[model samples]
Target chain A: MTYCLGIQTHQGLVMASDSRTNAGMDQVNVCRKMHLYIHEGERVFIILASGGLSITQSVTTLLRRDFDQGRGLASAPTFYDAARVVGEQIRRVGEMDREALKRDKISFNINVLLGGQIAGEKPHLYLIYPQGNPIQATEDSPYLQIGESKYGRPILDRGVRYRLTTLEEAVKFALISLDSTMRSNVTVGPPIDVVVYQNNDLRVRRYRRFTSKDPDLQRIQFQWEHSLRKAVLELPDVDFDEGAEQVI
Target chain B: MTYCLGIQTHQGLVMASDSRTNAGMDQVNVCRKMHLYIHEGERVFIILASGGLSITQSVTTLLRRDFDQGRGLASAPTFYDAARVVGEQIRRVGEMDREALKRDKISFNINVLLGGQIAGEKPHLYLIYPQGNPIQATEDSPYLQIGESKYGRPILDRGVRYRLTTLEEAVKFALISLDSTMRSNVTVGPPIDVVVYQNNDLRVRRYRRFTSKDPDLQRIQFQWEHSLRKAVLELPDVDFDEGAEQVI
Candidate 1:
């Protein structure tokens, strides 16, 4: 299991992914789910992958092989074209592995959030489904998440917007979403990778990995707990039936 | 779809359920998912159901049939016995419907969160699975949720504790959780039913339905959005590559 999120805002774009992977409770491992393809100032594409690790890794490896041969990412003229190339790569990998996986009773599955800006186009973000089709984020839905998405979706629904005018806020909200998932699910863990891009900026502005003990994260966790408790306590009580015996 | 949550705390228990049912996006309807059985000064048992509506309704009907025929709710010897009776009722319903559901390629699925106090037993909470087996809440895990539970689980993870000492706080947290789900998923909607039980109190302390127009709920929605935006804005920005052109 995994959790990955990507947001495209007026200010720029923010991408975050956790590094935990587990086959079962005792078979956990750490693997980077976020992959980057950069052409210096010309373009930078980030892909946050989730679902079966085998399928995603196969897709990533096939894309890398194409790039290594100068067939796709290195040569695609636009972000949209690059996305198509990535999609085709995923399809190619699926064609090669799906039958074998079916023989083992495993479903061929993978989903990805692909986002970045090219030299001449606006920065865009998309959620690529396991079937290779994709949906781009719009003003009404400025963020896309994959794998273990539900636990973190509510915060994004209430907080994210296309006019997220500040990169700081984007990062914070992304972390808070991750924090919520981490607390509730054992499959998602820390050492989170975050990358921020400023609108029109062709280069990656901020890229960092946050560990569990990071002071800022610790503070956010504590503050969230404290505030939640306070909020719960502040609500007015409802009237109870008079003859009700106290259960506690 | 439905969302129902139940929490057992030192002070008592809190149970809440949404009133939405849908066969698809266009076939949505309102239906209460909570059932309360209270015998003044003697016992009070709340059942919050979720999943396939038919299965849940059938299960509830079977339980009601037994109670009407003198099987134990108001006259239950103990809370454990009451729970067993509920479980037995579920099994009977499953026996009557499981094969037919399977014939239609539908899942024979429904879950219930049962909690409240009986005359001779302590306040207890149980999460009954589709198979009619149930797990009781303990000090380590004091809450159980059935159907569309993921969207609201994060808040509980961050706020609920066995030491949580007040029923009011529990009720508030439960509402907050429900509100989060309602915002993110259209299938879970307004007019939520909530019941708060005080330990040793044989009757319900508070019971009400919350709608989108409710003043208190509106206040919570506003405050939550404000606080969330504020929290996001306070997060530190990620350091990006200096020469990168801003994407916006």
Candidate 2:
């Protein structure tokens, strides 16, 4: 399992992923899930994946090789085309591995978040399903998440506004979302990978890998915990009216 | 299709549930998911349910009838036995409906959280599965949740302490959790039902059904939203150092 999310705010995009993967309780490992393709000054693509590790690795590896040859993401005219290129690779991998995985009772499962900007287009985010279909995020829903998403989703649902949240704030929100997930689930953990791309920058400018002992991560976690408890304390206390009807 | 949870603290227990049920996008209704059985001064049980509406309704209906006749929860000697009684009823319902549900491809799914005290025993909480097996919440993990649970769980993971959280705080946590879930999921909505029972009280007391228009519920929602936004604002900003290695 992994936790990967992308926030598309007015100022730019914030993409993040945890570095933990597990086949079972005893088979946990730290594996980076974020892949970047940069044709600097023209286009930048970030792919965060979750699912069967081998399948995702195969897809990314194929994309990387083609991208290096300037035939995949590098040559694609738009983010949508790049997404299709990714979907094609996913389907290609499915054709190769799906049958073998099914024989062992393993589903051909994988989910990918593709976020980037082409020189002429606005920054965008899309969620590519295991079936090789893609759906883009819109102003109405400015964020996309994959893998162990729910525990961290309430915060994103509440905090992210397409036109209101700045790139910095979105980065903060993304980290906090990942933190919440890590606290509630063991399979998603650090060192965390984050990329913040400012609109029109055409480059991955801000990136960080936060290990468990990073001081900044520690500060954010401690501060958020304190604020939440304080927030909970500040709420009005429950008052059970005397002789109230017990409806339940 | 529902959200329900139980928190057991040293001071007592807090149980809560949202009241929305939907068979499809167009078939939505408000149905209470929380039920209580009380033999004043002797024992009490609060059951919060989630899953197939017909299946849960059948299980609760059976429990209510048997309790009124003093044959089930009413006659149990301990909370564990009470949990067993509930599980037996769940199993009975499964026996009656499982095959038909399978024929129609609808799962015989029902999950229940039972929380209360039986005379001489400390307050306890149990989660009964579709298979009629039950697992009790322990001192280390004092809260149990079912149905649309993940969105509301991080707060509980951070705020609930078995010995430290008072019943008042537990009730507040339960409400906030439900409010978070309601915001993220349409299938979990209001008229929310909540019950708070103090240890050894042996009575059905302190219950409220919060309609969407309920002022207290509104106030809590507004306050929590405000606090969360404020908390996010207070977090330290991200500084993207130039020349940072791009790990992604």
Candidate 3:
């Protein structure tokens, strides 16, 4: 299983993904799920994928090769077109493999988070489904997440306000979300990769990857844990004297 | 859908469950998923259920009707036997319904959390499966949860240490966990039912139910949200000046 998410804050976009993949408990492996395509000042696209490795890998491979022969991510006219380009590749993979794999009862699955900047447009985020359909993140939700999303969703729901959060704060929330996920689930683990792109920067900046032992990751996780326990402890103590009959 | 859990703390055990149940989006309704049977001074058991309402409702109905014909939950000799009784009822329900449901492509599904005290035995918690098997929560984990468990699980992982926490603290954690689940998933909602059982009490005591509009429920949810955001605000800031190349 995989856990990856993208936050489209007003200041910019922040993306995070875990590095664990498995066919079963006995066959576990680490694979980088964050991919970046940069045409420098022209355009940039980040794809964070989760699902069957075969399907995601095939779609990304097709996306990487598109630059030489046809319209590629870097050449797409806008972020929307680039997202569609990704959706189309997912469809291409599903067409080629879904039926053959169905013969063995394996379902073709791939979910992609596509976010980045194009020179003339504001940065945007889209979640592409296994069915090759795409949905853009709106200001109301202000974030897109795929794979193992629920465990981390409440914090995003409560803390991420696109218009009020800064690029740096957005990055912080992304890591915190990932941290909550990793604590509750073993299917997701670090070496987590994060990317922060300021709205008009038009270039990738503030990229960092942390292994489980990384100091910054450790400090952030420890601080968050302490704060969480303190928060729980600080809650008003239950009044057993109320006799538990008080419905209010 | 539902989210119900039992925590075996040093002081006693804490049980909580949301009240929403649905066969489909259009078929949603409010149902009490928590059941209590008391032999008063001899034995007591609380059953929190999730999954097919037909299966769970059937199991509870049989257990409730047992006093007139067979041995009832109040008659179980130990907490362990009470758990087996719940599991056996589940298997009995499966025998009666599984094949008929299969004709309609619906599989028998229900998960139950049983927690209470039986005379001389220490308080205990058990999770019963559709296959009539049961697992006891141990000193190590000290908690059991069913359906929509993940989003609320991290808090239990962090705040609950059975040997270390007071029953009041455990109760606080359970409500906070339910709050997290309700915020992230629409399948689970209030009015939630909670019960606290102290070891060797051998009585059905301390039961409370909270509707969405319940003032105490609102206070807990609001306090949790405020503390959570404050905790996030108190975390150390990220230094983007470290540049994009850090990998550790």
Candidate 4:
């Protein structure tokens, strides 16, 4: 299991993912889920993946080969085209692995988030489904999540706004969202990878990996807990008014 | 879809449920998911259910009939026995309808939370699965949730401590949890039903139904949202330290 999310704010994009993967409880392992394809100032595509490691790795490897050869995402004219390139690669991997997985009764499950900027286009985010189709995040709904998404979603629903949220604030939202998920779910664990892209920077500049004991991460966890508890206490008390219908 | 949870605190038990039911997007309605069986001052069983509406309703109806006849929950010896009574009804309902539902390619999905106290027993909460097995909540994990549960779980994880939380705080936590789910998930909505049972009271004395526009419910929602935003703002800013490993 994994938890990966991408946030597209007015100033830029934030992509984050947990590194833990488990085929089963006994086979837990840590593997990087965030992949970056950067052409310096020309273009950049950050891909975060969740699902069967083999399928996602195969898809990424294929995309990398083409990207290294100056094809695929390396040459795509826009973020949408780059999403299509990733989708096509996913389809290619499906053609190679889906039948065998089906024979074993393993569902063909993969969800990918493609978020980046082409030289001439706006930074964007897309969630590519197992079927190789893509859905882009919009200003009204500026975030996309995959794997163990619900635990962290309420905070995002309350805190993030595409136009008003800054890149820095988006990073905070992403980390807090990831923190909420990690606290509630065991399958998603550290080290966490976070990348922040300033809109139009075209090059990846800010990235951080927070291991399990990272002091900053611990502080965030501790402080968020404190704040939430305090906030919960300050909220209006439950009005167990006598007028509501009584079941018994 | 539904969201019902039972929280056992030091002072008592709090059971809450949302009232939304849907066969699909086009067929959505409000239906009560919380049922009560009270032999006042003796034994009180608050059952919150989620799953196939027909199946749960049937099980509850059967339980109600027997409770009225002084044969089922009314005759059970302890809270565990009461849980078993509920589970037996679930299995009976499965026997009656599972095959027909399976023939139509529908899954026999039902999850129930049986919570309350009998005169001789301590307050207890049990989660009865679709297979009619029951798992009781313990001091270490004082809450059980059914249906669309994840979105509302983090707050419960953070706030509810069986030996420490008061009944009032538990009610606040439960309401906040439900509000979080309602905000993040369309399938779980109001009017919400909440029943608070004081440990020795046996009978449920505090019950409230918060319809969509209920002023108190709206205030809780509004204040909680405000508090959360303020809490997020007060959280320590993310430290995108330059020393952390950079992927690009």
Candidate 1 segments exceeding 4 Å error: A235-248, B235-248
Interface RMSD, Å, model 4: 2.4
Cand. 2 TM to true fold: 0.98
Q: List model 1 lDDT by residue over B106-146, tens digit each.
A: 99888888999877678999888888777899988888988
| Candidate 3 chain A: 10-residue stretch with minimal lDDT | A239-248
Please list the residue runs of candidate 4 whose C-alpha ends up more than 4 Å from where it truly belongs after superposition: A242-245, B241-245
Runs of candidate 3 with Cα error greater than 4 angstroms are: A68-70, A240-248, B68-70, B240-248
- TM-score (chain B) of candidate 1: 0.92
Steric clashes per prediction? 31, 0, 0, 0
Which is the leading candidate under lDDT?
2
> Please, what is the TM-score per model?
0.94, 0.98, 0.95, 0.98
lDDT of 3: 0.84
Q: Write the residue-wise lDDT of candidate 2 on A1-248 in tens digits.
A: 89999999888889999999898999999999999988889999989999999999999999999988989888998889989999999999999999999999999999999999999999989999998999999999999999999999999988899999988889889999999999999999999998998999998878888999999999999999999988999999877865426564
lDDT of 2 at A200: 96
lDDT of model 4, residue A19: 97
Q: Which pairs clash in the backbone of model 4?
A: none
TM-score of chain A of 3: 0.95
What is each predicted model's overall lDDT from 0 to 1?
A: 0.81, 0.91, 0.84, 0.90
Considering TM-score, which of the candidate structures 2 and 3 is the better prediction for this target?
2
In candidate 3, what are the lDDT values of residues B1-248, reduced to their tens digit?
89999999788888999999887888888888888776678777788888899888898889889944648576777777788888889999999999999999997989999888877788888999989899999999899999999889878888789788888888888998998898889989898888888888877568888789978778877888888877777778776534444432
At residue B77, candidate 2 shows an lDDT of 82
The recovered share of true contacts, given per candidate in order, is 0.54, 0.68, 0.53, 0.61
